[model samples]
Target: MSEQITKVNSWVLGLTGGIGCGKTAVSNMFEELGITIVDADIIAREVVLPNSKGLKAITAHFGEDILLPDGALNRAELRAKIFTNNNDKEWLNALLHPLIRIKILNDLNNATSPYVVLVAPLLFENNLDKYCDHTLLIDVPTSVQIARTVKRDNTSSEQVKSIIASQMSRADKQQKADDILNNDRSLNLVHIELVDLHKKYLQYALHNKTNSH
Candidate 1:
Protein backbone atom coordinates (compact mmCIF):
# COMPACT_ATOMS: atom_id res chain seq x y z
CA MET A 1 0.00 0.00 0.00
CA SER A 2 1.03 3.58 -0.57
CA GLU A 3 1.93 5.84 2.34
CA GLN A 4 -1.15 6.62 4.42
CA ILE A 5 0.49 9.87 5.42
CA THR A 6 1.10 12.68 2.97
CA LYS A 7 2.86 16.05 3.40
CA VAL A 8 3.07 16.86 7.07
CA ASN A 9 1.66 20.15 8.32
CA SER A 10 2.28 19.45 11.98
CA TRP A 11 3.59 16.79 14.28
CA VAL A 12 1.47 13.67 14.54
CA LEU A 13 1.39 11.75 17.80
CA GLY A 14 0.14 8.18 17.67
CA LEU A 15 -1.58 7.21 20.93
CA THR A 16 -2.45 3.59 21.47
CA GLY A 17 -2.90 0.92 24.11
CA GLY A 18 -4.19 -2.57 24.59
CA ILE A 19 -7.85 -3.10 25.40
CA GLY A 20 -9.09 -1.60 28.71
CA CYS A 21 -5.87 0.33 29.24
CA GLY A 22 -7.65 3.71 29.64
CA LYS A 23 -6.74 4.98 26.21
CA THR A 24 -9.82 7.16 26.12
CA ALA A 25 -8.85 8.78 29.38
CA VAL A 26 -5.36 9.41 28.07
CA SER A 27 -6.67 10.92 24.85
CA ASN A 28 -9.14 13.03 26.79
CA MET A 29 -6.26 14.47 28.78
CA PHE A 30 -4.50 15.42 25.56
CA GLU A 31 -7.71 16.93 24.27
CA GLU A 32 -8.09 18.96 27.44
CA LEU A 33 -4.65 20.38 26.73
CA GLY A 34 -5.94 21.61 23.32
CA ILE A 35 -4.40 18.82 21.28
CA THR A 36 -6.66 17.66 18.48
CA ILE A 37 -7.48 13.98 18.44
CA VAL A 38 -8.46 12.22 15.25
CA ASP A 39 -9.92 8.97 16.45
CA ALA A 40 -9.61 5.96 14.15
CA ASP A 41 -12.64 4.15 15.57
CA ILE A 42 -14.83 7.18 14.86
CA ILE A 43 -13.53 7.55 11.33
CA ALA A 44 -13.85 3.82 10.75
CA ARG A 45 -17.56 4.10 11.43
CA GLU A 46 -17.98 7.34 9.48
CA VAL A 47 -16.46 5.89 6.32
CA VAL A 48 -19.12 3.20 6.27
CA LEU A 49 -22.14 5.27 7.13
CA PRO A 50 -25.48 4.70 5.45
CA ASN A 51 -25.24 4.92 1.64
CA SER A 52 -21.52 5.53 1.81
CA LYS A 53 -19.43 3.86 -0.90
CA GLY A 54 -17.86 1.71 1.77
CA LEU A 55 -21.23 0.58 3.05
CA LYS A 56 -22.49 -0.06 -0.47
CA ALA A 57 -19.48 -2.15 -1.35
CA ILE A 58 -19.72 -3.99 1.96
CA THR A 59 -23.36 -4.82 1.34
CA ALA A 60 -22.55 -6.07 -2.12
CA HIS A 61 -19.90 -8.36 -0.75
CA PHE A 62 -21.40 -9.43 2.60
CA GLY A 63 -25.05 -9.14 1.57
CA GLU A 64 -27.82 -7.16 3.26
CA ASP A 65 -27.56 -9.32 6.35
CA ILE A 66 -24.51 -7.37 7.38
CA LEU A 67 -26.57 -4.21 7.63
CA LEU A 68 -29.09 -3.14 10.22
CA PRO A 69 -32.76 -2.47 9.37
CA ASP A 70 -31.96 1.24 9.45
CA GLY A 71 -29.21 0.73 6.83
CA ALA A 72 -26.32 0.95 9.26
CA LEU A 73 -23.63 -1.67 9.29
CA ASN A 74 -24.44 -4.38 11.82
CA ARG A 75 -21.25 -3.95 13.74
CA ALA A 76 -21.85 -6.63 16.32
CA GLU A 77 -22.89 -9.18 13.73
CA LEU A 78 -20.00 -8.29 11.48
CA ARG A 79 -17.57 -8.50 14.39
CA ALA A 80 -18.87 -11.92 15.43
CA LYS A 81 -18.69 -13.27 11.87
CA ILE A 82 -15.21 -11.93 11.28
CA PHE A 83 -13.88 -13.17 14.58
CA THR A 84 -14.91 -16.74 13.84
CA ASN A 85 -13.47 -16.74 10.30
CA ASN A 86 -9.97 -15.57 9.43
CA ASN A 87 -10.81 -15.16 5.75
CA ASP A 88 -13.80 -12.98 6.52
CA LYS A 89 -11.75 -10.88 8.89
CA GLU A 90 -9.01 -10.42 6.29
CA TRP A 91 -11.58 -9.55 3.66
CA LEU A 92 -13.13 -6.98 5.96
CA ASN A 93 -9.75 -5.45 6.82
CA ALA A 94 -8.82 -5.27 3.15
CA LEU A 95 -12.01 -3.36 2.51
CA LEU A 96 -11.95 -0.99 5.49
CA HIS A 97 -8.32 -0.40 6.43
CA PRO A 98 -7.39 1.68 3.39
CA LEU A 99 -10.52 3.77 3.67
CA ILE A 100 -9.92 4.34 7.37
CA ARG A 101 -6.30 5.26 6.74
CA ILE A 102 -7.26 7.85 4.14
CA LYS A 103 -9.74 9.48 6.44
CA ILE A 104 -7.22 9.49 9.29
CA LEU A 105 -4.62 11.20 7.13
CA ASN A 106 -7.06 13.84 6.02
CA ASP A 107 -8.23 14.50 9.56
CA LEU A 108 -4.68 14.69 10.81
CA ASN A 109 -3.82 17.25 8.16
CA ASN A 110 -6.89 19.33 8.93
CA ALA A 111 -6.20 19.53 12.64
CA THR A 112 -5.59 23.06 13.92
CA SER A 113 -3.92 22.11 17.19
CA PRO A 114 -0.18 22.74 17.61
CA TYR A 115 0.18 18.97 17.37
CA VAL A 116 -2.45 16.34 16.81
CA VAL A 117 -2.98 12.85 18.14
CA LEU A 118 -4.01 10.00 15.87
CA VAL A 119 -5.85 7.89 18.41
CA ALA A 120 -6.29 4.26 17.53
CA PRO A 121 -6.64 1.02 19.39
CA LEU A 122 -5.01 -0.80 16.49
CA LEU A 123 -2.39 1.87 15.76
CA PHE A 124 0.42 -0.68 15.69
CA GLU A 125 -1.67 -3.47 14.24
CA ASN A 126 -2.52 -1.42 11.15
CA ASN A 127 0.98 0.06 10.97
CA LEU A 128 -0.46 3.52 11.56
CA ASP A 129 2.66 4.06 13.65
CA LYS A 130 4.41 4.99 10.39
CA TYR A 131 2.27 8.11 10.12
CA CYS A 132 3.35 9.35 13.54
CA ASP A 133 6.38 11.39 14.52
CA HIS A 134 6.20 9.63 17.87
CA THR A 135 4.22 6.81 19.43
CA LEU A 136 2.81 6.94 22.98
CA LEU A 137 1.71 3.77 24.67
CA ILE A 138 -0.62 3.67 27.66
CA ASP A 139 0.57 0.88 29.92
CA VAL A 140 -1.34 -1.37 32.35
CA PRO A 141 -1.25 -4.93 33.56
CA THR A 142 -3.20 -7.81 31.98
CA SER A 143 -5.04 -8.43 35.24
CA VAL A 144 -5.99 -4.76 35.44
CA GLN A 145 -7.09 -4.90 31.81
CA ILE A 146 -9.45 -7.79 32.50
CA ALA A 147 -10.91 -6.11 35.55
CA ARG A 148 -11.35 -2.68 33.97
CA THR A 149 -12.78 -4.02 30.73
CA VAL A 150 -15.25 -6.23 32.50
CA LYS A 151 -16.35 -3.31 34.68
CA ARG A 152 -16.63 -0.89 31.76
CA ASP A 153 -18.17 -3.16 29.14
CA ASN A 154 -20.01 -5.57 31.44
CA THR A 155 -18.40 -8.35 29.48
CA SER A 156 -17.34 -11.73 30.72
CA SER A 157 -13.80 -12.04 32.08
CA GLU A 158 -13.12 -14.72 29.44
CA GLN A 159 -14.31 -12.45 26.64
CA VAL A 160 -12.14 -9.58 27.92
CA LYS A 161 -9.18 -11.90 28.10
CA SER A 162 -9.82 -13.04 24.56
CA ILE A 163 -9.92 -9.44 23.36
CA ILE A 164 -6.67 -8.65 25.19
CA ALA A 165 -5.01 -11.75 23.77
CA SER A 166 -5.87 -10.66 20.24
CA GLN A 167 -4.18 -7.23 20.37
CA MET A 168 -0.46 -6.42 20.19
CA SER A 169 1.00 -7.50 23.51
CA ARG A 170 1.91 -4.98 26.22
CA ALA A 171 5.62 -5.86 26.22
CA ASP A 172 5.95 -5.37 22.46
CA LYS A 173 3.97 -2.13 22.57
CA GLN A 174 6.11 -0.80 25.42
CA GLN A 175 9.26 -1.58 23.47
CA LYS A 176 7.89 0.11 20.34
CA ALA A 177 6.67 3.24 22.12
CA ASP A 178 8.64 6.46 21.98
CA ASP A 179 6.93 7.51 25.22
CA ILE A 180 4.94 5.72 27.85
CA LEU A 181 2.14 6.78 30.21
CA ASN A 182 1.62 4.34 33.01
CA ASN A 183 -2.16 4.31 33.48
CA ASP A 184 -1.90 2.00 36.46
CA ARG A 185 -2.00 4.95 38.84
CA SER A 186 -4.59 7.53 39.79
CA LEU A 187 -6.17 9.81 37.21
CA ASN A 188 -4.44 12.80 38.82
CA LEU A 189 -1.05 11.26 38.15
CA VAL A 190 -2.08 10.49 34.58
CA HIS A 191 -3.08 14.12 34.16
CA ILE A 192 0.32 15.28 35.43
CA GLU A 193 2.06 13.05 32.92
CA LEU A 194 -0.20 14.32 30.18
CA VAL A 195 0.66 17.90 31.08
CA ASP A 196 4.35 17.09 30.80
CA LEU A 197 3.85 15.35 27.44
CA HIS A 198 1.70 18.21 26.20
CA LYS A 199 4.55 20.63 26.85
CA LYS A 200 6.98 18.31 25.07
CA TYR A 201 4.69 17.94 22.06
CA LEU A 202 4.22 21.69 21.76
CA GLN A 203 7.97 22.15 21.69
CA TYR A 204 8.29 19.42 19.07
CA ALA A 205 5.65 21.05 16.91
CA LEU A 206 7.24 24.45 17.29
CA HIS A 207 10.63 23.02 16.37
CA ASN A 208 9.19 21.45 13.26
CA LYS A 209 7.36 24.61 12.26
CA THR A 210 10.49 26.71 12.73
CA ASN A 211 12.63 24.31 10.71
CA SER A 212 10.08 24.26 7.89
CA HIS A 213 10.42 27.99 7.32
Candidate 2:
Protein backbone atom coordinates (compact mmCIF):
# COMPACT_ATOMS: atom_id res chain seq x y z
CA MET A 1 0.00 0.00 0.00
CA SER A 2 2.85 2.36 0.84
CA GLU A 3 4.50 1.42 -2.47
CA GLN A 4 1.28 2.30 -4.33
CA ILE A 5 1.08 5.60 -2.49
CA THR A 6 4.54 6.50 -3.71
CA LYS A 7 3.79 5.97 -7.42
CA VAL A 8 0.72 8.19 -7.80
CA ASN A 9 0.71 11.84 -8.70
CA SER A 10 -1.49 14.29 -6.79
CA TRP A 11 -4.09 13.56 -9.47
CA VAL A 12 -5.96 10.28 -9.00
CA LEU A 13 -8.48 8.73 -6.63
CA GLY A 14 -10.29 5.45 -7.23
CA LEU A 15 -13.96 5.43 -6.18
CA THR A 16 -15.79 2.16 -6.63
CA GLY A 17 -19.03 0.39 -5.72
CA GLY A 18 -21.24 -2.34 -7.09
CA ILE A 19 -24.66 -2.03 -8.74
CA GLY A 20 -27.14 0.38 -7.07
CA CYS A 21 -24.45 1.25 -4.54
CA GLY A 22 -24.59 5.04 -5.06
CA LYS A 23 -21.10 5.41 -6.56
CA THR A 24 -22.36 8.01 -9.01
CA ALA A 25 -23.90 10.12 -6.27
CA VAL A 26 -20.66 10.00 -4.34
CA SER A 27 -18.67 10.97 -7.43
CA ASN A 28 -21.07 13.82 -8.18
CA MET A 29 -20.49 15.19 -4.71
CA PHE A 30 -16.75 15.07 -5.35
CA GLU A 31 -17.34 16.93 -8.62
CA GLU A 32 -19.15 19.66 -6.73
CA LEU A 33 -16.24 19.71 -4.36
CA GLY A 34 -14.12 20.60 -7.45
CA ILE A 35 -12.45 17.33 -8.37
CA THR A 36 -12.28 16.15 -11.97
CA ILE A 37 -13.61 12.64 -12.61
CA VAL A 38 -12.43 10.00 -15.08
CA ASP A 39 -15.18 7.48 -15.54
CA ALA A 40 -14.37 3.92 -16.71
CA ASP A 41 -17.83 3.48 -18.25
CA ILE A 42 -17.11 6.46 -20.48
CA ILE A 43 -13.69 5.03 -21.32
CA ALA A 44 -15.33 1.66 -22.05
CA ARG A 45 -17.61 3.29 -24.58
CA GLU A 46 -14.82 5.31 -26.13
CA VAL A 47 -12.76 2.17 -26.68
CA VAL A 48 -15.58 0.57 -28.63
CA LEU A 49 -16.41 3.49 -30.86
CA PRO A 50 -16.75 2.57 -34.56
CA ASN A 51 -13.47 1.63 -36.32
CA SER A 52 -11.41 1.86 -33.15
CA LYS A 53 -8.99 -0.95 -32.27
CA GLY A 54 -11.39 -2.33 -29.71
CA LEU A 55 -14.27 -2.38 -32.17
CA LYS A 56 -12.07 -3.93 -34.81
CA ALA A 57 -11.01 -6.69 -32.43
CA ILE A 58 -14.61 -7.20 -31.34
CA THR A 59 -15.91 -7.30 -34.88
CA ALA A 60 -13.22 -9.72 -35.94
CA HIS A 61 -14.21 -12.05 -33.12
CA PHE A 62 -18.02 -11.61 -32.97
CA GLY A 63 -18.49 -10.53 -36.59
CA GLU A 64 -20.67 -7.67 -37.86
CA ASP A 65 -23.80 -8.72 -35.98
CA ILE A 66 -22.32 -7.02 -32.95
CA LEU A 67 -22.53 -3.75 -34.85
CA LEU A 68 -25.75 -1.77 -35.17
CA PRO A 69 -27.47 -0.54 -38.34
CA ASP A 70 -25.74 2.78 -37.63
CA GLY A 71 -22.41 0.85 -37.39
CA ALA A 72 -21.82 1.20 -33.66
CA LEU A 73 -21.16 -1.90 -31.59
CA ASN A 74 -24.41 -3.35 -30.27
CA ARG A 75 -23.53 -3.11 -26.61
CA ALA A 76 -26.69 -4.80 -25.39
CA GLU A 77 -26.13 -7.78 -27.64
CA LEU A 78 -22.50 -8.04 -26.60
CA ARG A 79 -23.38 -7.62 -22.95
CA ALA A 80 -25.90 -10.43 -23.06
CA LYS A 81 -23.50 -12.67 -24.92
CA ILE A 82 -20.68 -11.99 -22.50
CA PHE A 83 -22.86 -12.53 -19.45
CA THR A 84 -23.93 -15.93 -20.69
CA ASN A 85 -20.52 -17.06 -21.94
CA ASN A 86 -17.72 -16.62 -19.46
CA ASN A 87 -15.19 -17.50 -22.16
CA ASP A 88 -16.45 -14.77 -24.47
CA LYS A 89 -16.41 -12.25 -21.63
CA GLU A 90 -12.88 -13.23 -20.73
CA TRP A 91 -11.88 -12.96 -24.37
CA LEU A 92 -13.49 -9.52 -24.56
CA ASN A 93 -11.80 -8.43 -21.36
CA ALA A 94 -8.47 -9.60 -22.70
CA LEU A 95 -9.04 -7.54 -25.82
CA LEU A 96 -10.14 -4.34 -24.10
CA HIS A 97 -8.73 -4.15 -20.60
CA PRO A 98 -5.17 -3.30 -21.61
CA LEU A 99 -6.40 -0.63 -23.98
CA ILE A 100 -8.62 0.88 -21.34
CA ARG A 101 -5.81 0.76 -18.81
CA ILE A 102 -3.49 2.61 -21.13
CA LYS A 103 -6.10 5.29 -21.70
CA ILE A 104 -6.76 5.61 -17.99
CA LEU A 105 -3.07 5.83 -17.18
CA ASN A 106 -2.69 8.62 -19.71
CA ASP A 107 -5.69 10.44 -18.33
CA LEU A 108 -4.51 10.09 -14.76
CA ASN A 109 -1.06 11.23 -15.69
CA ASN A 110 -2.47 14.37 -17.30
CA ALA A 111 -5.21 15.32 -14.85
CA THR A 112 -4.78 18.88 -13.47
CA SER A 113 -6.64 18.57 -10.17
CA PRO A 114 -5.48 18.23 -6.61
CA TYR A 115 -6.79 14.76 -7.19
CA VAL A 116 -9.21 13.24 -9.70
CA VAL A 117 -11.89 10.63 -9.04
CA LEU A 118 -12.02 7.39 -11.03
CA VAL A 119 -15.47 5.85 -10.76
CA ALA A 120 -15.11 2.25 -11.91
CA PRO A 121 -17.48 -0.60 -11.24
CA LEU A 122 -14.62 -3.03 -11.93
CA LEU A 123 -11.91 -1.26 -9.97
CA PHE A 124 -11.31 -4.27 -7.81
CA GLU A 125 -12.31 -6.93 -10.31
CA ASN A 126 -9.93 -5.73 -13.02
CA ASN A 127 -6.88 -5.22 -10.80
CA LEU A 128 -7.06 -1.47 -11.37
CA ASP A 129 -6.70 -0.94 -7.63
CA LYS A 130 -2.95 -0.81 -8.24
CA TYR A 131 -3.49 2.40 -10.19
CA CYS A 132 -5.07 4.15 -7.24
CA ASP A 133 -3.24 5.35 -4.17
CA HIS A 134 -6.30 4.72 -2.06
CA THR A 135 -9.53 2.87 -2.79
CA LEU A 136 -12.89 3.96 -1.40
CA LEU A 137 -15.90 1.70 -1.59
CA ILE A 138 -19.44 2.99 -1.14
CA ASP A 139 -20.70 0.21 1.07
CA VAL A 140 -24.42 -0.64 1.01
CA PRO A 141 -26.27 -3.60 2.43
CA THR A 142 -27.32 -6.40 0.07
CA SER A 143 -30.93 -5.68 1.02
CA VAL A 144 -30.48 -2.07 -0.04
CA GLN A 145 -28.87 -3.18 -3.29
CA ILE A 146 -31.73 -5.51 -4.12
CA ALA A 147 -34.43 -3.01 -3.16
CA ARG A 148 -32.82 -0.14 -5.02
CA THR A 149 -32.13 -2.08 -8.21
CA VAL A 150 -35.58 -3.61 -8.31
CA LYS A 151 -37.27 -0.25 -7.80
CA ARG A 152 -35.04 1.92 -9.97
CA ASP A 153 -34.64 -0.55 -12.83
CA ASN A 154 -38.20 -1.87 -12.55
CA THR A 155 -36.71 -5.34 -12.50
CA SER A 156 -37.82 -8.48 -10.69
CA SER A 157 -36.21 -9.66 -7.48
CA GLU A 158 -34.57 -12.57 -9.27
CA GLN A 159 -33.23 -10.28 -11.96
CA VAL A 160 -31.68 -8.01 -9.38
CA LYS A 161 -30.25 -11.05 -7.69
CA SER A 162 -28.64 -12.15 -10.92
CA ILE A 163 -27.02 -8.75 -11.36
CA ILE A 164 -25.67 -8.81 -7.85
CA ALA A 165 -24.46 -12.34 -8.38
CA SER A 166 -22.41 -11.12 -11.32
CA GLN A 167 -20.47 -8.67 -9.17
CA MET A 168 -17.88 -9.45 -6.47
CA SER A 169 -19.55 -9.97 -3.10
CA ARG A 170 -20.17 -7.02 -0.79
CA ALA A 171 -18.11 -8.74 1.88
CA ASP A 172 -15.15 -9.00 -0.46
CA LYS A 173 -15.47 -5.34 -1.37
CA GLN A 174 -15.70 -4.22 2.24
CA GLN A 175 -12.65 -6.21 3.19
CA LYS A 176 -10.56 -4.55 0.48
CA ALA A 177 -11.70 -0.96 0.93
CA ASP A 178 -9.47 1.68 2.52
CA ASP A 179 -12.59 3.60 3.46
CA ILE A 180 -16.17 2.37 3.38
CA LEU A 181 -18.90 4.97 3.10
CA ASN A 182 -22.06 3.41 4.46
CA ASN A 183 -25.18 4.27 2.47
CA ASP A 184 -28.07 2.16 3.74
CA ARG A 185 -30.20 5.00 5.09
CA SER A 186 -31.05 8.58 4.19
CA LEU A 187 -29.71 10.29 1.06
CA ASN A 188 -28.57 13.17 3.25
CA LEU A 189 -26.45 10.80 5.26
CA VAL A 190 -24.94 9.37 2.09
CA HIS A 191 -24.09 12.86 0.94
CA ILE A 192 -22.64 13.63 4.31
CA GLU A 193 -20.45 10.57 4.05
CA LEU A 194 -19.29 11.61 0.62
CA VAL A 195 -18.47 15.10 1.87
CA ASP A 196 -16.58 13.69 4.79
CA LEU A 197 -14.73 11.26 2.56
CA HIS A 198 -13.87 14.03 0.12
CA LYS A 199 -12.25 16.08 2.86
CA LYS A 200 -10.47 13.06 4.27
CA TYR A 201 -9.11 11.88 0.91
CA LEU A 202 -8.04 15.38 -0.03
CA GLN A 203 -6.28 15.88 3.25
CA TYR A 204 -5.03 12.31 3.25
CA ALA A 205 -2.98 13.34 0.20
CA LEU A 206 -0.78 10.32 -0.25
CA HIS A 207 0.36 10.43 -3.89
CA ASN A 208 1.57 6.97 -4.74
CA LYS A 209 0.99 5.20 -8.08
CA THR A 210 2.85 1.93 -7.85
CA ASN A 211 1.70 -0.77 -10.30
CA SER A 212 1.62 -3.71 -7.95
CA HIS A 213 1.39 -7.07 -9.61
Best-matching candidate per lDDT: 1
Name the 10 consecutive residues with the lowest summed lDDT in model 2: 1-10
With a 3 Å backbone cut-off (N, CA, C), the pairs that clash in candidate 1 are none
lDDT scores for all predictions?
0.90, 0.82
Candidate 1 per-residue lDDT, tens place, 69-169, comes to 89899999888898899998888888888888888888899999999999999999888998899999999999999999999999999999888888988
- Count the clashes in each prediction: 0, 6
Write one digit per residue (lDDT tens) for candidate 2, span 69-95: 999999999999998999999999788
For model 2, the superposed segments whose C-alpha errors exceed 4 Å read 1-8, 83-87, 206-213
- How many backbone clashes are present in model 1? 0
